[model samples]
Target chain A: MTEELNARDKEEVRQEESTHPGRSYRPDVDIFETAESLVLRADVPGVDESSVSVRLDDGVLSLEGRVSVQDYENLTPVATEYPIGNYLRRFQLSNDLDPEGIAARVTDGVLEVTFPKSAQAKPRQVQVTAG
Target chain B: MTRFRFASPFDSAGRLLTLQREVERASGNPFDAEQSPSGRGVFPSTNVFRDDDGLTLRMEVPGVSPADISVEARENTLTVSGERTIQIPEGTSYHRRERGAGRFARALQLPRDVDPTNVTATCKNGILTVRVAKSENAKPRQITVQAA
Candidate 1:
């Protein structure tokens, strides 16, 4: 069952990749899980909350962040150590997550997304009865 | 062995960058006393660029506040140190934590003798751009072409 779900998500991700032809860089992401929620953090420098957009549709979470500008009219970039481009990445959500409950925030160029787990999906401690 | 190392296609660009910097250092020119980026536990990647003015060091430190960061320059070494404080909500817990938490400090050598007083830094978006003006001799000045 897990494999089936993952494969489906992978297909969606592949579709997402081919759809965008413009230059897009993948933001480095960190994902951690707790008992009740899953947290995702992406390193997106040169982007603020206004330029970042998060969307969830049918278990596919798409994260897109655009850099306001890469070149300047007067200042010539003699040497560029880093590449400037938009960021795009798509993630597949499983049934265990509540897609409708997903929330995100951008702080200091870092985008954090929180996904709350469904009640039935959360980890629970089973009580023991002693006779 | 080298060919096998690049089997994974995920981070080929990053690996290529390191290799390019290494090649430049191997050439070993007078100006090549490279003050390269020594990324040691630095949150985001770093880049050091040199121009006629002096040098510019950029570090991608997302989520790190300007107040928490400190920079010190002595001789030719420029050290940038900072920490990103992790704030977990009161009633919430993290399931997956990919972004590193806690404090991190990274220091690197500078390419030229910079004017300490002239150094300026600005944090935009999440990138910290540091400009170190070159010393008097290092600054570009063209001598008058005498008509012989």
Candidate 2:
């Protein structure tokens, strides 16, 4: 059997202070590039569409998600392997992407963000003439 | 009297599978599981919670459809199995691929037998929760003292 992939616990974020009262984890993410845009997908279980936030400022993209702690309010843990927490992570975006054209959505607890490439960054076809 | 008997994250079968994977890695297998910076473990890591009524099992299965997952309870064992698929458009080039895909099944031994008919499951925002009610015969009972 192949080894299964496990979720990683993100260490404390020392750079910024969080307004939320719980731990902030770095959600697992996959990034890829298509012809028109750069796509990113992150696993943020427990977070719905309204609880997720995506912002780009000064070439840095930030992702944050808050999980509803109310779900486990009265339940006591019998055997625990993974902890519940909010999600936080950031990425540096190159100038080739157009910040205004970015689009994001959340489904099945996976957040997908598509950053469209700037007009100048797209490939241009040059006309070849007979010499 | 022991009130609870908790099962460790890795049961006998789980340990054996881990050992086999380790041996394969030592033998220079190319399809080696992607060694994440945080290392590897079972998929859809699970958490078990208990209350007066029953036990609840929660698993993280982002991007997985509810129809793809299955839960079964037999005797005192609870088994969760499912497949996760990630779709990528054609001609896409990956810069970072950390999410792993495929079929995963985990069997967990419960502290007591559960009523098969009383079990229920639900999925929301990629989290799957299975609630198994304790068997009628196993539930805790209170005995009242009669006036002497």
lDDT of 1 by residue, B1-102 (tens): 554554543354344334344323432221212333541223435555555677666667777888878877776666676777666655655444455555
| Interface C-alpha RMSD after superposing true interface residues, each candidate, one decimal | 11.9, 12.2
Question: Which 10 successive residues of model 2 chain A have the least lDDT summed?
Answer: A2-11
Candidate 2: give the clashing pairs: none
The reply for model 2, stretches above 4 Å from the true place, is A1-15, B1-40, B140-148
Give lDDT tens digits, candidate 1, residues A64-119. Answer: 88664432212234333345556788888778998878899888888999889999
Two-chain complex of model 2, DockQ on C-alpha atoms against the true structure = 0.28
DockQ of each: 0.16, 0.28
What does candidate 2's lDDT look like per residue over A80-118, in tens digits?
A: 656667789899988999999999999999999999999
RMSD, each candidate, Å?
11.8, 12.0
| Backbone clashes in model 1 | 9
DockQ-based class of model 2: acceptable
Instruction: Give me the overall lDDT of model 1.
Output: 0.63
